[model samples]
Target chain A: MNLKVENVSYRLGKKVLLDNVSLSLQERERVAIIGPNGSGKSTLLRLICGLNKPTQGEVLLAGRCVHRYPRRRLAQSLAFVQQKANTEDIVRAEEAVSLGRTPWIKPFEAWSEYHQGFVEKALLQVDMQDKRHQYWHTLSGGEQQRLHIARALAQNTPFIVMDEPTNHLDIKQQLGVLSLIHHIERTMLVAVHDLNHAMRFDRVIVLKDGGVVAQGAPETLITEALIKEVFEVESRVIKSMGFASNVQLIA
Target chain B: MLVKGLQGVMKSHPLLFVLVSTLTLSVFIVLGVAIGETQIDFQTVVYAVANGALGTQYPINAIDQGVVWNYRLTRTLVAACCGSALAITGLVLQSLLRNALADPYLLGISAGASTGAVLVTIAGIGAGALSMSFGALIGAILAFMFVVALAALASGRRMGNISTQVILAGIAGSQLFNALTAFVIAKSANAEQARGIMFWLLGNLSGARWQEVAMAVPVLLFGLMIVLWHSRALDAFLFGSDAAASIGIAVKRVQVVLIFSTAMMTAVMVSMVGAIGFVGLVIPHAARFLFGSSHLVLVPACAVIGAVFLIVCDIGSRTVIPGQVLPIGVVTALIGAPCFALVLIRGQRK
Candidate 1:
């Protein structure tokens, strides 16, 4: 499903978080949203996932107003993986993943074979099949984040809006997560902090002060001038080994 | 291989364990009917129950049948229902609030019921017409409404931002109702009224009646249905508000419905059988330990185990000493406090 945000604005009390921002995503697109701290990247993703209503203007999913869609219907199209890794201590990994099927199952019906297959696939996709029986609190930070991603995958939605999927991962785990996202065929809107990983995405949307500053193909949009303008950093983007981009500070 | 082993354990043990526990509970219920202050023999009690329920051609006296089935059996059922309802309510509230300490009475239901029971005892109003259970029901509903209103006021007329505010409102309302109960008790006109009020406050199932059971069962069943219907939503809540909303749960609406339904069920149960404590506070955690944290299993497990626990406690209260029945609440607290302490200790070790 394609998502279109038109002139969307949001305010928290008196402060504006997102201001009249507009963006669009084509089907099966992998778009990275990158911004400096407190630049409303997470807020924008929340708005897209229907967790927060826009203060003004509209978000359309395939030409219909996003709010008009029933909550389950919207959830069936898009799932959200949050930045917070830990849930309650009692939740098992498999039970946590099974929650993704909640929007589809009616009350009192036993989980069907299709739901089981989806959970199995999700656990396999995140490579957490071995840890499926572990308590949520017992998992390591990166493993918990992967489990969160698995939960989103178990929803079997075509699109996923992720808020910092690699927030606390070590270098190796971060690459593993980014590589997993890159290899997946579904549309993903991810808020990422690392420019190198963002560069590998099909598209990047740069935000400054709650509004879109620049958006285009990663190669064209992520220039030295834009980095200095938006991020206040002096940086170099180098084409590195294995077709992956590497970013470094020049100063 | 490990997964298969775990699955085998779950399949082989938990269901059989719950089944055995349920059977033991039914036996306790039957035993409870037989061993009371009246000193009826086992065969006579069985004959009485059969005569009362099935109208069998048994040579049972009318008075014994009435005492066994109409009075003792009804009280037992009411106690079981109240225990099950409160435990299930605790399960739902803990899951909803994401707090281990939340219970059925967390919304000021008990204090409200206490206040109403106290008021009736002090004023001597409706002494001939209204039962203490009715007074408790009124008090519980009022207290529940007051808390809801306080929450609404704190949240500026919206149920948003309810995570901490509802609990705070409940605490404030509890204090308010407790003070009111104390004041009413202090100004009572007679010593007998004070004793009655005190007994009600301490919690008892001595006066349970068929009429009370008739009122309590449907409310308890309704509350159970509400919790079961929203078990998935409760699971979503454990992920916190944003993730829950992202998954298409109407968090605020579900919270309101759950709280109101739980409070209503609690009021009915408390009215029917004074203010039994600790069953709600400890049984859900007990259920969690036995059957993982899935609400699908947790809710029913808590209900069943809670019923059995209370039935056994009531049996101990009645039969532990010959001819003297202890307050049901005291027995539960005696049992639950140590269990709660153990859970906390274990949690700290973890």
Candidate 2:
């Protein structure tokens, strides 16, 4: 496993944010975490990404305990993309993207041509080539989302973790971002609100009340009964759409 | 647009702009020395610098040397150092705290320093600049520690001080310290002593000497070097704390380093010359308007511009009325507040 979370638990004061969650990822594998709000998907991702410490167990990256790895080394191995990357800074789009090269650059050193290449290629991949010089705050919400993903892409880490990578994107841009993520050759652990996006993943982890309710290949774990049991909502899994099937949810 | 033009020039030759600005400040120093209460000639000022007192190019007087070197030169250098120190502190603090309004004084250092100064003067514990600066440094450290601890708690013990809690804590801390200083002065001092304490509270650069400059310059250089060394980590902080951490920055360590350096600089500066407002508050924003938020460019720009601003304000304070000195703190707020407003308006329009 390129990345492993073994029996991790987290408590925010008295609230058990996550309870004994375990998962593993192979090289270049894509896994989606699907759950309703307050189900610990984001918290689990946060723990795995080293943003928060787990109360129990540990996260291992590249066969080393994550806590033991130096911060820059950990950042070089994994990149995190958020749904919204908010900043008080009034900076150009290209400058914001260049921040991804920070782990590679040393203190007081300028970003090299090699670093700029990564940023340029990522922007091009996101189709934000023309908006490179534009102010980040002025960009549309969808554009901003793409730019942030591009920032993660620029990091060129082997493991990528995202929380709602498709939020704020239009339909075309949504698919575009997914296709972009899909085409990238990396291990992806994504928390996705859209079940359609999750179904396309190689595997899915279903979360409920801060516990792992089910985990399997999406086709097996994503049955209507499980959805009904967890979300308390009726859902129908229609066939013929492959893993990208329409999982219709009714109120 | 004026700033845009300057930025365009800066984009191509940032070194040249910084050098030229430094050169401009050097000329301002000479002018500041030359055009004091006595209004000596530029030629004589140059002669005093180049040829010394005994055997000059043109018969220079002892009074001229005394006024130029003993008074103006020392104050000018202090102003330059103060400006650079406060401006760079503001730049680093704003980035570290992720607050646009963060400045050297925002952490309660200035208020605490004032309290220390008042205590010393009223109780007659220590006289002279050295002991006064020592007292102020002690007071500043106390306030800085308290505010930082409060901010850290408010941020849920997170390593970074970027939370709104730090700012709120600082505001409270400043009010408490400022009130304590005021109460000490009002209650303890006789009329003459109170007047003197009041003058110091309004900010003062009078009686500036080479010793004060000697004390401030090394710390100023040290602070600048440390900030320059941590420029990349500081850039990481431009994004919120979580993002900075995700990128592998030791955010807690960086925040502690930044807090210490800025507080140290502010303590030294405020102790030497009272808490001159607005340089730390507004200069970084003005520098940002010219150069984007990249600290590599922004920090240098702030240093140069901030020096020029304080020196210019110093000149105004010197010449505003015939021999009646005005507190520099007054002029900086009077000027810096409007400049900051203009920057906000222009930014919004852009």
Candidate 3:
């Protein structure tokens, strides 16, 4: 499914949160959205996921307005992993992951092995299969974040939208999650804070002051100039380990 | 022992678990009917019910049969309905609002009902035309509307975290209504009338009758069905409303419908039985501790456990003080407060 945000603007009272922000994604594409704080990255993700409506424009999926379809139908094709989602409910790791099957299951439908298969696969993907029976509160912050990603993965949607899925992870787990996203046969739109990590995605969209400043292939768009302009930091882009481009912030 | 035994049954066979729960409710209802002020035997209570329900010609005292069939049975059934409805409301509110302390009375329904009943009884607001229950129902609806409006006003532009605003508004509305009730009673009521109104406010089932049973059961059933139908959506709310919406739930629609339904069910139960406390606040947590947090299991578990808990409490109210029957609310609080503390302590340890 192709996801398109056409001239979306969200305003809260007199303050403009997102102004005329637009982007489009092709099927099986991996796009990273990077922005300074208060640049509306989370707002854009919420709009695209249909958790909130765009004030002036609309988000469309496969040529239909995203809000036109029933929430269940929309969710069957697009999964969302929220940033820093937490719950007070006492749920096991596997039980929490099983909720990803919600869009697929009817109200009284029996949870068949087919559904359970996705939960197991998701747990394995996040490397939390060993802790499937553990309580959610017992998990560390990074592990909790992984479970959130695993929940999105278990939804089995073609388009997955996540906000800072790697926020709390250490370097090893961060790379593991990124690599997993890279290899998956799904279209992914992820908001990331790490400019270095953002450089690896197939495409990058940079936002500053509620609008898209630049977007395109990582190599072409993420030059030293764009980083300094958008992020307000002196930085250099260099070839790291032969095949990868790395961004190093200059002091 | 029962909680552990139930855990084992829940893990092994879902059908057997349901059967066991239903049996427990039935047993409690029978015990509630039998062991009242007049000690009707268990067989006699069952026979009286059969006679009343099926026209069975059982040779029993007319007074005993009448007491069992008309009074105790109706009281116990109404108590069960109130417990189930209140617990379901609590579970739904806690999950939807993401507040652990949410309960049926948190929306100010109980306080409103108390005020309304007081007005009708002492102030003679209805001039003997409106019954206390009807007045209470009206008050509950009015108080709920006030809370909703206050919550909306407080939240204003940012509707993101309205649940907290709602909790606050409910607190304010409850305090306001409770003050109104106190003021009215203090101003107008004589000692005898004040005493009666106070007893009713503390929760009384002395007035529960067949008519009440007829009213309460269907409301409970309807409320249960609505809640069970939305159990999946309720589970989605574990992570909050935004997460629930992202997972295909129509968060606003579900919230409005469930909240309205639970409120209506609670209003009816409160008017019928004077706002029995603790079942709503404690039973869901207890159920979650025994069963898992999945609403699919939690809903049924709460219904059964809540019914049994209230039935047992009703029995305690009748028999605890020898000749004089204590108010049902007092018994529940006397028992529930300690049990709730224990639940909190156990939860913290876990």
Q: Where does candidate 2 chain A have its weakest 10-residue lDDT segment?
A: A237-246
- As a whole number from 0 to 100, the lDDT of residue B125 in candidate 2 is 61
User: Can you write out model 3's per-residue Cα lDDT over B251-333, one digit (the tens) per residue?
Assistant: 87898899999999999999988988888989999888777687877898899888888988999999999899998888887
RMSD in Å for all candidates? 2.9, 2.2, 1.9
Better of 1 and 3 by DockQ: 3
Clash list (residue pairs), candidate 3: none
lDDT tens readout by residue for model 3, A120-182: 999998889999988899998778888888888888999999899888788987888788777
Error of 1 at A31 (Å): 0.9
Where model 1 places Cα greater than 4 Å from the true spot, the runs are A239-245, B1-24, B61-63, B124-131, B156-160, B189-191, B342-350
lDDT over C-alpha atoms for residue B82 of model 3: 91
Alpha-carbon TM-score of each model against the true structure: 0.93, 0.95, 0.96
Ranking by lDDT: 3, 2, 1
What are the lDDT scores of the predictions, listed in order?
0.82, 0.84, 0.89
- State, as a TM-score between 0 and 1, how close model 3 is to the true structure: 0.96
For candidate 1, what is the total of clashing residue pairs?
A: 0
Q: What is the clash count for each candidate, in the order shown?
A: 0, 0, 0
- Residue A108's lDDT within candidate 1 is 68
Question: How far does residue B109 in candidate 1 sit from its true spot (Å)?
Answer: 0.9
For model 3, the superposed segments whose C-alpha errors exceed 4 Å read B1-12
